[model samples]
Target: MNAPPEDDLSLGQPNVPATYFKDQRVTCEKDLYKSLPPLINGKAGYQSLLPDHTLVDTSNHADPNSEKGAKIRPDLGHYEHGVVSEEHPTMLDLIILAYEVKKARKEDIVNDTMKCTKPLPHDDCQAPYENTCQTSTITRGQLANYATQICRRQHRTHFYMVFIFHPFIRFIRWDRAGAIVTKRINYVEDCTPLVRFLYLFGRLDRAGKGFDPTVQPASQAEAEEAKKYLKRWEPKLERTVFKMDVPAANGKMRQFLVWGSLADPESPLGRTTRGYPAVEVIDGVVSAKPVFLKEQWRSVAVRPEVETLKELNEHGVLHVPTLLCGGDLPGQETKTHEISIGNWRVGHKRIDKRIHTRFVVAEVGQPLENFPSSKVMLGAIYNAFQGHDQAYNKCKIWHRDISGGNILILDNNKGLLSDWDLAREEADLDNGARAHERTGTWPFMSVGLLQQPNKQHTTRDDLESFFWVILYYGLHYLPHTHRDSLDHMMKEIFDQYDFAERDGMARGGNNKDALVRRGRYLGSRRSQQFSFIGCQPLTEFLFDCLDLLGKWDFRYDPTIQSWEEDGYIPASHAEMEPLWRQALQSPLWPVADRAVDQVRLSKRLDFIVRGERPERKGSKRSDPHDSIQDDEDDDDECSPRKRRKTCHGSEAAHL
Candidate 1:
């Protein structure tokens, strides 16, 4: 059969002859370039540029498949003539447009020579890319950026080809709307010829049909099936209700709501959004080998918890939901793409960033907007703290961003520390100080991290964030008649914690007072919890936690008779554990004694509020000795001097 016209991009639609893809006598790399049809505009001459921006190859002489048109012609594609060259005089202009060209360092000759001496054992050279010799590959984001640069420079959509290797190519159509699609094509017998012709013609097959990159799951029925499968996997997921498509960091996302199980249906999980369950369906092409991707980091940080929680729950030491599920999305080809710039990797590429789509089922709980607390709050947060300690010390994963939303209170009054997206391995920490971007929720960040944004974050910072979480919620959410005072205190706290702005201006100015220590009242607010004074032990716990924060805030600059004056003792988990235990043991601590039915505790508190004597079975009064104290008489109970003497003495003894 006669070959389809060279300009026809739809060669695949017809029954292409087997001879069409038969190998011809290839002379040099230039012959391969020429054999391919002109892709940009109507003119020909395509060249592959190396990392150094040098023309690696541009010879265009067709042999057999593209033997008809073999001359090097001028490029009149979407990009203006000369825009394709790395040294195109407008290169600096491109960089200004944010198309950064990050060059990889040259390989070490001695090490590379030593490596190639013999056939490397499969185990020895398992990660050949890890060797110093490999040139750093660019990412799709980088391609998108460069395409954007071309578009901005020319004021029009530009069709660009990013060649990772001969058989691997990314077809990019960039414009004001962004990349139409970053299509990765792998060379195969029949398809290779068609891909070559399509690129040469500057048109993807079905060109008039607008390119839609938004991933539509093969079927909503299949997605629904996936949800049902997850519901079966974890019986806690009741039913998914609302779903909306959203942009994903790594893939297309479909965010859906599920009806989740209460932490403890029998016990009262205080202040929960019971009907709302968090479910996200991440759907995208599976685009890399599992071994060579940063998805492993997420696996390391998130997974193992399913089994770890099982083990911890069995032992009765740490308790949390076996919440995370969904491995690789099923029913997709395991295709691999080149390492590209995405959320995980920005400037440099170390490993492949796989685009994954899966159903992420997790517990959704109350937000901290106007959250109220009970005695169970103490125990719940304590257990949640223990959960963090377990994840850090036992699992070797640190929850870097522990803010209000990251934790949830279950129906049973159990607190679950969640949202491990910012969690990192202890090993990755050796890479040096963290960037300011990873400073978690700005309000919950530690003073040191807030003040010196580039400083290395430690577990101490996370602990401090947790401290702020408790204080912020406790101060703002406590049901007190002093609404005016609470509002003022809330404004004060928000001012101190809002690191992004100051007195109204962005903190971009070098204002020394903007530092956390200088801006806020540290120990002053503890005295303001007038209503909570009757809960003496709880008050003491709060003071002690604040004391630790105060010491940590000025850890380096010690006072004349400071806690660390005689011996420099930095805050550690060991010191905090006793405080958590003390908080748990408080009579006012919620869940000190849990009821199968949570309403009983509410009734007990209600009866106590009414100043009535208990009259019914199981109508228990909590801490009966404290009944006479009212908010009016509670001032003396919460006196800073008294709390300092008692709580400080206990903390010192523990130290």
Candidate 2:
């Protein structure tokens, strides 16, 4: 099938300097703080009229004579003593008052004054009025939020007794009365995975009261065998956790389910479902047997991946998960054969289990959903392209499916290209030109493939996909307009258009509505939108690629408005390698240099979207980290040009 017209392309001088990247360290703790908003001080702004109709400082009420304290003291008879009078006071009020005082002080110690008081106040003298905070019932959400805030500031040490006095203090009474509610956290829940992992391994608080002894190997021989075999084959194997119980034969074999990851020398497949790390009970002794668990898939697509992985491993590409072992299941064509005791499936399988494939590899690190920096994202793209180069040139294998989810970013700050189930040998392309079925993830698929009917897929299209990935990341990561009229049109085109429609003569295939259509056109249109007007560097970078790809083929001239007749010079990986490398080194959009952290980049981009200059010292270009500062000159109108062209139609139609 003939390819569709190329995207309108314009070549602009590269904006970012090559070889200017600088690395900066980032940790999970810093990222978490940046991502979530800090807790508000419970009493800082909490103000309401006292019983006597006087405004008081509920937050900073440390001194009795202070404005808020002066209001709170007269009721407790502290007007004379500056402390709770021994004569008369309600027990609940005293308890709550003491807690509030302690809260105002931000102290951890439970003052003795908060304990039970004697001689209840006479009915005539008692006010029986509740404090402002205690007048309402505190919901679990409020408590959790306040608790989280306290822990965030204090490093998870203390849980202040924030007594909300509205509607009366009834938490103690409600509990004593056996009222059922969502379980309350008495202390801040420590949910850090590493902390829990260490606790499981007896690395912290080794009391061994309820700890399972089977977490580690039972015998020294088993331990040595595990250490020796894993060291020789998968030296990166670090922490292992016992998962489940496995059925054994005649009570002779002790079987358990386990999963682990690479330790020192990191690998990409950090977390995966391979097989259980078990200590097999043999003839009265336990032995370690780390057998690979391979699943069965209907398509022979996995064969190429298995072969490619083996070849890559041999060449010392250890960042990618190295395959341990693989084989087809026996007895049922594609059905797995019974191997040993610790070889059962852990999770639920589909109705047709035969379509599934299970393979084992040296576990790498966990997958990261978000990137730390645009430089890091570019670094990942760079690494992926290098892998593609090696796979195509050295191994003669072409990865057909390159999507965001397939390429994993590991903890080692490295990107690992994976999930090659749709890959085919390069020889397949050389043999003959044939109409191949449409394949690839929708979001990052090549523009030519989207508009064109059945065509021979090539490595050039895959590289084009990498460009789309970069653009997609910037748009997705950088904040944009919330209620812009342009956004509505853009969303409508992406959400309502059909990307994979086929005509009756051309393969009469099933056509369905999709979230997006005309990938190249959509990208081009967005590049020109007012939302992207200020981000010319990034937009121009993408446009330049379209220009280059179009030029690679003699059939199309993106620079000219006219179409050319027949002769085709299909783009090759070798021809586009330099362009791709240049794009990687080029400067990104505002505040996108590696030196600027993700948090700052997000804020600056948000400001740019609002048609405002990025504020403060961080926006200055002098320091790469502080670059992209707002300029008085950049506060241009936020409307798109009147005749802006779009994917389905011009923006003027919507206007």
Each candidate structure's TM-score, on Cα atoms with residue i matched to residue i, is 0.43, 0.40
Model 2 CA deviation exceeding 4 Å by range: 1-304, 315-320, 329-356, 363-368, 429-435, 479-540, 552-569, 583-655
Query: Across residues 170-221, which tens digit of lDDT does each residue of candidate 2 receive?
Result: 1111100011111111211222221122122221121121112223333454
The digit string of per-residue lDDT tens for model 1 on 437-521 reads: 3335544556665555455668787787777676655554444333334545544453343233432211211221232334333
Clashes per model (N, Cα, C within 3 A):
16, 25
Residue range with the least summed lDDT across 10 consecutive positions in model 1? 646-655
Give the residue spans of candidate 1 off by over 4 A: 1-317, 320-324, 328-354, 357-372, 431-437, 480-482, 485-488, 495-537, 556-568, 588-655
The alpha-carbon deviation from the true structure for residue 7 of candidate 2, after best TM-score superposition, in angstroms, is 71
Query: What's the lDDT for all of these models?
Result: 0.37, 0.35
TM-score computed on alpha carbons, candidate 1: 0.43
